[model samples]
Target: MMRKTLTYFLTLFLVIACSTVPITERKRVNIVDDAEILPASFAQYDTFLKENKLSTNKEKTQEIREIGQRISKSVDRFMRANGMIEEANQYKWEFNLVEDEQMNAWCLPGGKVVFYTGILPVCANEDGIAAVMGHEIAHAFAKHGQERMTSSYGQQLGGVAVALGTSGQDYETQVLWNSIYGISSQVGMLAYSRTHEKEADKLGMVFMIMAGYDPEESIDLWKRMKADSKGGAPPEFLSTHPSHDTRIADLQRYLPVARMNAREYGIDE
Candidate 1:
């Protein structure tokens, strides 16, 4: 009992210690870490790219790079203006378009991004791609990875408590701890993904405007996504993100703010 109690407090402390303190008030946006988390993330993203088939279309690949650079620059400007220049400097953004048909794209910590080729038709143009890129890149800015790690650490401590409370011997306790860590890590991944999607929706709008693309495009893109779904997503709450309906509606609500931000940047929306 004593051991479990102590473990819980320790884990709680780690979560607090590692959590990102937003530059403003009580977390208009929650953030995570790049400096502490990126090394592992980079290696993993690199390996995934190496193992997966890559797009051979020269022009298409070139286009992804160009768009990524333009959007990244815009995000840099916004960050600098907000006194987050130091945070922006931590990014070493790179874009790669892969030849997968999953209609998926993701950005890793420290600005490593990948686009699956299957979604090109959905993207449709430079502006369309900007919508997706802004959202994915926004995940990094929100520090979802660090948030996940911090949350996982807390869960891990809970597992340690279980092991300590129930396991009578050293070997049994060790086994229980390992199992706890494994299961909790998987759960943490799913929860963090939802947070990332929301973060992207917010920050990505900011990026698109800064990059000379209209943030309202995000609403149109999500509308297309729902049409592509043809129906509703099945239990996305358990897997990747919110339901398609939920995402599209949220986009609708935020479009006005995004549009207003673009006007501030002199990008006529």
Candidate 2:
């Protein structure tokens, strides 16, 4: 009876928390409140800036900031046009270039963006930078962090449910169940991350196109990334992101749709 009650409430909670992502319209569960998460994200971002070295290359820094501004403006336009005024107002967009050697970049919630210098060579050009920038921004635009937090909570609740359901089992059986649950939940989270990556890829293409970037450049960027990997990347099923080949193919397939959507938005470039 207790197990059934827990299950019932869990389902109810999930249903109430369900929402759809903008543009892609994919259903997501996000129980974490923006009011609760945004301030924390901003504070963390401030701390990160204090701990990290900002790039000294004025040229590269200006370029990143310009691209970020263009893309963010496009995003804001889209949101406001689609009746997302409140959401648009929530973002305090800022971009920075960090003096790091890692080929990495990320966007925190509320649009705090960082670009590592090592990624510039891989970007190869403005279009490539836009590709990476759009992708990272899409993660924040999609509220993936908040969704992930909600997913963690759900996983913990599932652990509780597993414990309750196995209370009558022998110790050995209980141990086995828990081990299985742990492995499965970890894998599930990885899969969830992959989903977010794919969604971000698609959404990024659209945003880049809207910002007058060449969508085809995204495919080329992935190809370059694949070459840089030299075949050392983990298998797709085991990784938190899609493989490079998969991303390249996805961008290729998504290019026409992205361009069409941008045209519809009156962005003809």
Candidate 3:
């Protein structure tokens, strides 16, 4: 049973894994497509806006929109120039500032973005905002969320396989195997998530540079983020995110590469 299950999953993985991200070119499962996902994403975005308080500070709200627009335009231009016009066209960009104080922001697939006022202070100015927004947009642009969904699906399939393989085993043996499988699967997922975060950081820096923002601001932003954490975080290997130190160092190391890539787009900074 284990052999048969493994064979089946391997075949399925081979058949469906084809999509490659734009900048990173990382191979990913094509199990989910934009057409099938965008309607739901858009609906959820609308519902979220309806449920949340939109910021009343007109000046701040305008600034959020302006930063978002500039970053989105830069992304679109880069994608179009790189033979990804169809992918770029699929994005319907919308950015809003919410009144929450959670110091959080996210970009939903298909280019819907929400910035909490709480994070604005962390993103102190236009360049800082570019750093944050660029990172969020990078996650969407690289289709990391879609890849995560695919990975979750694969994990579920793995669980199912384990169940089938252990069906004939003793109760104690079954429990042990199941526990091991669950732990390994969780660890794999966490590793996958960390990789995605690192990829976003790199791509975000590139986008920010191309958008005419200083890539160095990325390091500064992460430093601010680390200070905000108050030195409290799980070890890097155990967390879904790299340690703040790791992120800062990575951004500092990659800033030069990002700037060099920007030159290709005629953005020499």
lDDT of each: 0.74, 0.93, 0.86
The clash tally of candidate 2 reads 0
Q: Top model by lDDT, which number?
A: 2
**178-258 per-residue lDDT for model 3 (tens digits):** 999989988888999898899889988888888888778888988999999898998888899999999999888888778
| Model 1, span 85-176: residue lDDT tens | 78888888899999988999988888899999988888887888999998888777667666666666566566666666666768866776
Q: How many clashes does each candidate structure show, in the order listed?
A: 1, 0, 0
RMSD of 1: 4.7
Off by over 4 Å in 1: 1-15, 18-33, 161-192, 261-269
Each prediction's TM-score versus the true structure? 0.78, 0.98, 0.94
C-alpha lDDT of residue 40 in model 3: 90
Q: Which 10 residues in a row give candidate 3 its minimum summed lDDT? A: 260-269
The candidate scoring highest on TM-score is 2
